[model samples]
Target: MTVRAANAEALRRLLAAEPVLTDCVSAVEAIGLEPGVVLHAGPPIGWQVMCAPVQGAIVGALRYEGWASSEADALELVARGGVRLEPCHHRGAVGPMAGIITRSMPVFVLENRAFGNRACATINEGLGRVLRFGANDETVLARLAWLRDEAGPLLGKALRRSGGIELRTLMAQALQMGDEMHQRNVAASSLFVRALLPSLVREGTGAALERLTDFLAGNDQFFLNLAMAAAKAATDSLLGIPGSTVVAAMARNGAEFGIRVAGCGARWFTAPVNTPEGFFFPGFGPTDANPDLGDSAIVETLGLGGMAMAASPGAARFVGAGGVAEALRITEEMREITLGEHPYFRIPAQGDRGAPVGIDVRRVVTTGITPLINTGIAGRKAGVGQVGAGVVRAPFGCFTAALEALAADDG
Candidate 1:
């Protein structure tokens, strides 16, 4: 079969997979993660080259793992190679900004029932001085501890008891409710709470339960990471299809942006990261923003986040797209670089057209159009939380490189 044909078939299987949130487990127990191991977002990079947020997050992970007691100790350990830093994507996982995953952290597990594939993501710690944003101060540590002690275990029990939440179902519903399942997850988060409220209430009592409920209620973007895991589980199934050009993943680590092609195995094509253009929070501006960061772009990989923009007019202003028309333009532009429209994720504004899916490197390079991503902007300095939100385009060089490699193989 032709590479394009194979890619189309692979994407069909990917979009067909129905991922379900089945359980929650510690990174250690679930993925056999161990101490002295830190998983960050994007391609594998060493400590010396890591961006500030990533470096800060690694230090936080070290402290969380009890391998270091202070920022100085963490710095010394990382600089001296006392701990190993790997990409979360390499470990069947996904994370948001900095995307730090540690052994003791609890991760939500999602399984693609159609193909029996699974992927996981760490629970979202809401905005403001959060660890994922590179803050490792006492407040951050205390919040992580509270989640470890109360939320994770309780949610695990509730999920197992409820027989799991159907993630794709939530995604379909959420798209209709104005959530692209990335930058905006208000609907998905609410739906998740609605689905689990009974289980949460039935399985517990008092402050622990109240805290979990409150956490879910307060974090509007709680379901974004879950959507990313679901997308990862679905797309991972498309990997290893010889001749297929479907992109398996796209991620960035402040310093670089990278992508993995379906037929390219583990190889990564990387380029310098691009700064996102968008609005900033109070006292924050473009100068203070880190280059695009996070594994959450997995959502866009599956055709939701930015590609579903026309369906999510409510999210436009927040991500720098001024209005619905601008959002539609972004989504329309993506269709040119993608293989086809998604079969399930429909955009109402586009007359129920499927969201664009299957990023094609050849088309991307030929058109000089990269995938669009809507994301949170972390502060450039370590330890500062999210400073703004915006839209970014994956660097064109990554696609050109991937296209060149594919051309060489085809010959």
Candidate 2:
């Protein structure tokens, strides 16, 4: 077992799995996801190096896939390619920010149930102008068509009548109620609407249970893209693992900033996408942000956003830090480039320890210290949605090119 202790025991059995939100289909039935195939986020790009909030969410997913008919004919059919962009982590799926995913939207699946594996995302359209911050106007295509016609079949019939929804026990009770689940998912969106409020009142009513209870009581980052599709279904089960320097998927697409390593199977060790810094929003700043975009940093590859910013001092004062001892000194500089700790995402100010999970691209190129996300700045051009909230790092040339491609696969 010495391929780096079998890659730290395959990332300690992928941080001891347990994803579970079960279902809420339709990115063409949870992942068959056909039609025009748009899924965006980071790494597999095109449409002429897309960016302006992923070309305004690919012209709001080509007008939510009618194929066009405005947003300038969906940017002239995505500048004449006519959709088909790909890379919602090559489709197990994960979206947030301009992480677009189209074909009749409504996602949120999850699954990992100790690795049966499945992910998917899509539903949160709460923020202003929406369409994952790219804002495909018309009130973000009528709130993505009322989250695809009345809150995705009443939250997929209250997630099949609550047969599922353990998402790491609502991310360990939303990191003890302060939520470090990527830019604060306010107590995991109030414990996922109090476990879908008894099946959203026994399957909704009156404007579909008051527009799914005012879109989950006004989105406190609506459980951050279902906790980034349950951290991409629990780290896509530690990707390939060969000699795993673990760090599986930390996306972005407002330009670039990828990374996928558990033995580098799916490649993508990108760079460039930076521009975060912090605090802005009353008339915006940093020249109207947007650079680091979404896949909601796959919840810092499964530890908790910003590697559990010291158990989230209100997500380190909403990403600008200056409290809880600068969020426990940025979780002690992310426990020196992370390798382990998340036995259950603990972190009560670092004494209750545990939340730093395996990011180790050779300990981020021997501690150059990348990976400190906590984002949400978007709106550089697109329709001007989110314009501030900060901290962003991940990109020391994607951990020195995944440590020079794991030292050229060290035979």
Question: Could you tell me every candidate's TM-score relative to the true structure?
Answer: 0.98, 0.34
lDDT of 2 by residue, 1-411 (tens): 345885787677678888888778678888787777788887877777777877787787788668888888777776677668888889889888778888788887878877698888888877777777777867678778777887887898888898987878778868976789888888888888888798779878787788679778987888888888888888888888787777888898877888888786788888888888888879888988878887888888887888788888877887787678888888788878777787776877677878888778777787678878888888788878888889888879978888888778865
In model 1, residue pairs whose N, Cα or C atoms come closer than 3 Å (at least 3 residues apart or on different chains), thus clashing, are none
Which pairs clash (backbone N, Cα, C closer than 3 Å) in model 2? none
Residue-level lDDT of model 1, residues 243-269, one tens digit each, is: 878888999988899999887877889
Estimate the Cα RMSD of every predicted model relative to the unseen true structure: 1.0, 18.8
**Which ranges in model 2 have alpha carbons more than 4 Å from their true place?**
11-16, 22-50, 54-94, 97-130, 136-138, 141-201, 209-228, 231-233, 236-243, 260-269, 272-400, 404-411
Which prediction has the highest TM-score against the true structure? 1
Error of 2 at 261 (Å): 4.1
**lDDT agreement with native, every candidate:** 0.88, 0.81
Error of 1 at 141 (Å): 0.7
Candidate 2 worst ten-residue window by lDDT: 1-10
